[model samples]
Structure formats: C-alpha cells, structure tokens
Target: MTAPVAHAPVPLQLKRGGGDAFIVEHSEEFVTLASTAPSPPGSTVEATHQGDAGPTTVRVKVRGCRRDPLPDGREGFRIDGRFVSLTRADRAALFGSQSEADPGSTSET
Candidate 1:
C-alpha cells in the first residue's frame, strides 16, 4: 500500500460563501477538505489558502464527498477535489517556489 499523504489542517473558505471548511490534506493535483456540508461531486468550487505570500485562490472540481467525524464529535463531510486551474503565482504561493515548471501547466511563457 502507498503511504498516506501528510498534511497540516489549514482553514479554508469557500468563495461561494458556505458555512466554513478546512483543508485536511493537499497536493499539486488534489485536496481533501473537511466541511460542515457535503459538496456535490462534479461541482466546481473556489477555495483560498492563506499562505505567507497572501491568500491563494484555486478552482477545484469536486470528485467525491463522504461523511466523516469532526474533531468536535460532530458529523462533517470529507470533500475530495481535483485542481481545475492554478496559475504560476498561485502555485508558488501555495507550495513555495519551484525552480522548474509546475505539473500539468508550465510557468509563464
């Protein structure tokens, strides 16, 4: 089996104005979010990750969502999504500077 992806929980806010959400894990291609409500799969949503550079917003396509237990013992939704679009600056802000081109997209021409 593959090792689990290690990630620190980071607070995230849905641009559409939802209750609240947090990123439980993330990678260049996908993110798993813990949300108060279920986000339907195939839906596109925007979320911003506050990094040292500033708030980096990314558009994501919801792949799946399932019920999960929250830290407070309340029911929460575990939302999985794939990155739909990300700019070079957004990649640098969210994952730090990359000497080479980002995966799935190249840096500025």
Candidate 2:
C-alpha cells in the first residue's frame, strides 16, 4: 500500500499604508481586514497568493489611539481577517525561517 504525503503550511505578509506589516501562517485558508476612518482614517490591507480564490472582504471601525502611545502619540492600526494561501517564498520565510533548503523541499502541485 502507498502512503499519503503531507504538505507544509503557507505563509502570508501584509503591508499597511503606514509601513505596518503582518505575517500569517496556515495550511489552506484566506484572510481579510477592513476598517473605517476616524476623520482622517487610514486603510486596511490583506496579502494573498496570485491565483488562489475565496472570500476577500473585511470591515473594521477605528476606535481611539494606542494606550501607550506610538512615537508621536499616534494610535496603532488594527485589522480583522484570516489566511487564504501563501506563495512558496512566503512559506519559506514564515515556516523555514528564511533558511535555504533543497529545492525539492516544496512539493509540486
């Protein structure tokens, strides 16, 4: 009898307008983060693979600034979402710790 093979998890990278960054790791899933403005509100962002598909909508509301203050008393941004898919490089950066492994480490689809 033949055995089934296991695949590694995927990694995600999110970049907001203000240079904010997010990293997510999952097997097969999607994520979305959306938020409203606060007079001069910013934006919400989510990162995903090129061809993967699924729900891609998120809604959020801006509350107040950060309690501890950020540099110039700027409040931190927040998002709500989930993981969808990750590219091979994203996977390595997240799971493999950016290590250089055998090219065959990743399975062919």
Candidate 3:
C-alpha cells in the first residue's frame, strides 16, 4: 500500500478573506482541502509556517468549492485545490516532524 503523503492542516490566507481548512488529503501533485468557509473558485490559497527555522509558504490554486453541512447543523466548505508550490518547512508543518509532532494542530473542522 502507498503511504499517505504528510499534509499539515494549517490555517490559510484567502484572497478575499480567511477561513479554515485541512489538507484533507494529498499527493505529489495535489492537495485537497476542506474549509470551514467558502473559498471563491480561481482564488489562490496560501499556508504560511513560522518556527525556529523561519517562515515558509505553501501555495495552492483553488480548483472548485462547495458548501457542506456540518454534523453540528452548521455549514462548512469543501475546497479542492492543487499544490502550486511547497517549501520544505511547509512540508514539515503539514506532515509530522520532531519540530511539529502533531501537524494538523490547528482548529478542528
């Protein structure tokens, strides 16, 4: 079986506004995102990481977006995107590492 690529579900900066999303799943070519807010299609997403090492960025392009009902009876967004670029530090933050043993340490979906 192929091991899942380590993806850090960190907060992202939206073109118009900021919501939240998990790097729900990923591959070498793309990363799928699930957000708590709607992301406009054709927008660019940015994930920034800061630590002892410094800051880095993970950029993705929004391919599509949709709203889904949450279990709490609230609404959320499912944003599917493709990775445009990912720095090494960005990778470590998404996947687990000694620096960030728990990658997706951000807010819950």
Ranked by TM-score from best down, the candidates are 1, 3, 2
Off by over 4 Å in 1: 1-4, 71-74, 97-109
* TM-score, every prediction: 0.69, 0.28, 0.59
| Residue 99 lDDT (model 1) | 54
Give the winner by lDDT.
1
* Poorest stretch of ten by lDDT in candidate 3: 1-10
Local accuracy of candidate 3 as per-residue lDDT tens digits, 1-109: 3334544455453434564556667765577766666667798777554544565566778889888643334577766777786755566655645335445555556
| Per-candidate total of colliding backbone pairs | 0, 7, 2
TM-score of 2: 0.28
Off by over 4 Å in 3: 1-16, 49-56, 69-74, 97-109
Query: Please, what are the lDDT tens digits per residue for candidate 2 over residues 1-109?
Result: 2222223323223334323222221223332222221212243344432224432222222222122322223453323233334455454444453324334455555
